[model samples]
Target: MSTTKTCVRSPVPTIALCFIVALFEGLDVQSAGIAGPAIAAHFGLSSSMMGAVFSASIIGLLPGALAGGWLADRLGRKRVLIVAVMIFGVFSAATAMVWSFESLLIMRFLTGVGLGAAMPNLIALASEAVEQRSHGQAVSFMYCGLPLGGALAVLISNAGLEGSWKAVFYVGGLGPLLIVPLLCLWLPESSAYRAQKGRDHSAPTRRLRVLFQQAAARPTLLLWVSYFFTLMVLYILQNWLPSLMMSQGLVRSEVGTVQVALNLGGAIGSLLMGLLMDRWRIMALIVSMYLGTVAALAGLGFSSQFYSMVVAAFAAGFFSIGSQLVLYALAPRFYPTSIRGTGVGSALAVGRLGSICGPLVAGQMLATGSGAAMVLMAATPGIVVAAAAMLLLVAGQHRNQR
Candidate 1:
């Protein structure tokens, strides 16, 4: 592998830039949750209304990822990415100024569009920048920024913000706006994208159509399925874990500690998973991760003691978030650079659908008097389904290889 890890000429800098962008993504995600309560109190809104506001941004992500990925292929990754940053930054700051629930929903949805657009472009740029052997390292390491960003938002909120939820949005907004100039100066466009653009003056829609061709169809469908279930379980934990834990008689303060443990484990998991992927067989690694995740979820649901729950949370993060990074690392390899943006974006858009459903299902289950443990256990069957999809994907890849 070429160790041409240089600035302006190398991917290291681009990966670093993507990591910063991922931090903004993570920061925005946590900020909404942290601010949701204060925003509700301020507006005298019910929990359902606030939940709608939260879902608005997520709803925007589906189209954002779709349109952003499509545009990145047609226009350019760097261009789309910068515009995405600006969209989120400006609208997210505007979120602080909303006078009512409707306004808040609009701003958040707009901000989500920007975030959605940024994701596949960032992944495309980073994935294309590096050697194939190092793709996992680049993507997974870049994602470490996500959990870190979440952690940063929490710290800033707890220490810096003076009971004003808008302060979180201010920090979230300012970071990306400030990064835009630096991205323009330092972030290089994907060489693969540039090459494809040079050879084909084809319209973007034409290129997108290639993904549905016979050779691509099976893998595309399976990838979308895998992404869906993968995100379903993840968002379930992210959205409902705290509430579920508190309902289980855990003290409020301890719930915060649980989040810390989970995110900290997530960071470590991303790092380790990246290293392992570069060295191990991906199939073996993925199977290990899936089984480990099932174990962790089972443990989390079954354990009643304080220490066991915390340990389970840590293990859950280690396996689930870690596996997500692995899947992301693997995603780009499924498509040539020509439609990589579209492929990744489409899969993520599907994943967002699962994200939307995760919280809703969890809420309904809980409302119906389902135990916290059972609510979590509900994800196990989905994980098994996802694992089967992955195996089918591997089998299909082998056939293609032959």
Candidate 2:
């Protein structure tokens, strides 16, 4: 099934667009966390309530991803992506208008839906733009926007927002709207999608019940389990690291700097590993990355000094978040383009659910009077388990191919 391969003369433009959308997702995903203090202060909320708010968008993301993927497979990746960007953009901007706790929760949940819809389609589009073998690097390059956006969120919140948390939402929200036209004008639809549509017009509109088809069932289950554990640890840190550090007696001001380091490490590691993935045994490389994260998490558990914790955080981010990005790069390869969006979206839906559980679970762990160090140490093994799942996934995938 040959596509109108002319939709992409090069991968750069497509990647750039996906990168921008991913950046928006990153910003909004981090928006609640970065603004956590302000939001709590403004609303006079409890830790449990804050946890609910933190989980709101992520919960919304669960269904958003499922529906978005199903639609993108049929409606067109570009169209789905554009609508997704708009959904998040408008909702994020509306976030600034919330005057109460419940209002903020609703707005964030709506915004999450938009964010969830955009990601899988962006992943699918970017992978489709490049040649098969180069997909690892291409999708990795595209996902770097996530970490970059996280870094930018910290910068924007502290450097530019001037203490008003609403300012951060304003930037995270309306900024994506301005990018929509550029996407319409420049970002091409997935040529692979077009080819699939050409072959069977009816296929595009079908529901996503096919994820468990005989050929896909094993990888799908493995992908879901791996995604669940990885996202659990990743979001636990993303949402709670500052609180954890503060609980341990670290200076309050250093939190932002440490977050920047963590995200910077994620960006660097993602690019380097992306290249290696195209050339190495992907399971071995990914497992090693998670193992390094386990060690870093252990380091963070014991580190009493400021600089050491920062270094440990950076390594944790470098490996865990970076490994997750590689999984994004790898997702499209496991399924045919016909259901690519569903495959990736399904994997992420479970992960998003895990993300919702992550912060809440961390909150509960802290509630039990556990020290930050002990909690982190306990969580490290979850990532180890996720790495094991990926090892099995790679073995099953290889066996299936043969």
Candidate 3:
């Protein structure tokens, strides 16, 4: 697949491609959550073993993200993304036929390679597609596909679909297959990426080094800290909310409904935050973090009733998931184009570590069965307070930079 030489300018097609990519990515992620019980039942695996299976994917994501970012920078965003989509699609289907737990873990880990690689490419592509001023809106809009795709996966699985767990993977696998042809036809190479590639490679490397040094050194350290903590909370909620609700004695149908509500809230949050980001970047972040703090606390402790739980779940999804999507949108603006992929990829790779720990910690807590719920609730205040402090530091640094 040769990269497109001509710069394409249509936002609609570009956004459509991003949405499709995000849809399949979200489908693959949500499939595991939806199918966890079935997989455990079929294999008679303990919760710890199940956690390992899910973590396998995250483990693969670490390398996938780093490699995908480099590939997008070196080759082209469109090419790498198409390859990733196909890889995940094929492996997800293959996972359905795995005869044992170890086999399933290996397959999912391979699929995670594809899944992790696909996301940063989407972010980079979307960021490059639009004007700098509109970058946040563009990225946030594209990421809406994440929550929507997740919601679709849950809804489809909940609809019975022959009551087979494998159906979830089938749907997830088919999504990328459907998107690949369109991607080949419509997706365009990023102009910014090409411009960067055309530059003196050594110059770009130097610039990247400076950017990282700046980011890691003083002022930007706060941004990285906030980014890490925010993702820790967000990923934990996304990966475990359904299971947590089930632990609360909700039926599977109710779990699906709550998941849908949460995702729906995320969709709304992404759009709202994107708009807000354009006008008030720092203020918007602060407000979203505060909302996330409240929602998380509410979701963990209160909300015993079905409707109340749904509301709390929706708020949690909106604030936590929504805020992180906003952060991705805003990330590119903080760094120069020379090292944009590296910066974003590094942040995401670090966040993936947090994501990896989240499920494991939750599983261990569940196993202990003492103060488990409270401990989970405690993640909210701890993360939010840290995030708030970091953001304040970032704002102070920005003021000083000015």
Candidate 4:
């Protein structure tokens, strides 16, 4: 193995800058959820219509993920990230101003495109900036901004602001706007990416096809499968857990508190897992999956016991959500720098399909009176699936080396 003597240090200022940008990106992504109730009330919308509003953004995300990766590979990560942030911010503000449902949906979809594009580039940038050994920790630390941002949204909403949910959108939109100039000034282009792009000799299509082909081999396939199911469970929890608690007669403030706890646990878990990754990569994955599975089951089976429920939620957040950060950390190491962005972005893009399905499936199941137990139980398959996939990946890696 060839190791570079670059000895890149993740400076506090640069990481802080990246965290703020990532925070804005996360807030923008979750703003719709914060604003959904008010929007529905304003428009006298049906539940189905409200669901469509939520779905539109995710629909835009699919193409955005793929396109953003390709763009970052071509134009550079910093440039694409800044542009996406600006686009999302602009559309988010536009969403706040729009009166018609159709217009709001259109703006939301556009914002999703920006939001989706931002994440992969952020991952690519963070992964490339750090030394290989510290890759997992750096990426996990960077992604901690996500759950923190979501928690911030809940806090802002709870403060009983005067302008209703529209205020959340305005704030969410302005966050990225504020960060854009700072990002341009402080965020450097990925040095590794720049070097690889300079050596590019093939058509972009050929390049992409080749990258996808490389990803089709055993370990890559296993990683993608693991990522897909993990995302499914994570997204389901993110979108439905609050509502699930609310349905069990928990007050809105308590529901928000649960979300905060979940996020806090996730942040802590990511940091811990990052450290563990360097020492026991495969063992860390197994432990995370097993913890997630147990947490899900516990949360579902003991919905009425507030403390137990919270503990279960915390465990789920700690294991499942943080595992995602671990996945992003591991992704760059799995592929060479030449296709790092593509590999990570494609995994994220495909994983997002599972994210979309998760909420929808949970919604249907909840309607059928599946209860918290069923919902929590639903998460088990995802963990088991992910664990099996990881084992396959490990086996594949050993075979490849041999």
Top model by lDDT, which number? 2
Please list the C-alpha lDDT of all candidates, in the order they appear.
0.82, 0.84, 0.76, 0.75
Clashing pairs in 4: none
On residues 1-402, what C-alpha lDDT tens digit does candidate 1 reach at each position? 667765446788889999999998878866776565567678997545655666778788889999898888888899999999999889888888889888998998998899888889988888888899899888887988877877676566556346567887888999989999999999888888987895555666776678888788888888888888988898777766766787788874566677667777788899899999899877888899899889999998988988899999989988988988877887888887768888899988998888777767776776678888898889998898888898888888878889
Clash total of candidate 3: 0
lDDT of 1: 0.82
Candidate 3 has an lDDT of 0.76
lDDT of 2 by residue, 245-357 (tens): 87778664687787888888888888888888899988789778988888988887788888998899889889988889877887788889878888898899999988998
> Which candidate leads in TM-score?
2
How do all models score by TM-score? 0.92, 0.94, 0.91, 0.91
RMSD of each: 3.1, 2.8, 4.3, 3.2
Better of 2 and 4 by TM-score: 2
Off by over 4 Å in 2: 1-8, 198-207
In candidate 2, which residue pairs clash?
none
Which segments of model 3 are wrong by more than 4 Å?
A: 1-8, 200-211, 214-220, 370-372, 389-397
Residue-wise lDDT of candidate 3 within 283-353, one digit each (tens)?
65766656665655566556677787788778877877777786687666666666667667666666677
Residue 399 accuracy (lDDT) in model 4: 73
Q: How close is candidate 1 to the true structure, as a TM-score?
A: 0.92
How large an RMSD does model 3 have? 4.3
TM-score of 2: 0.94
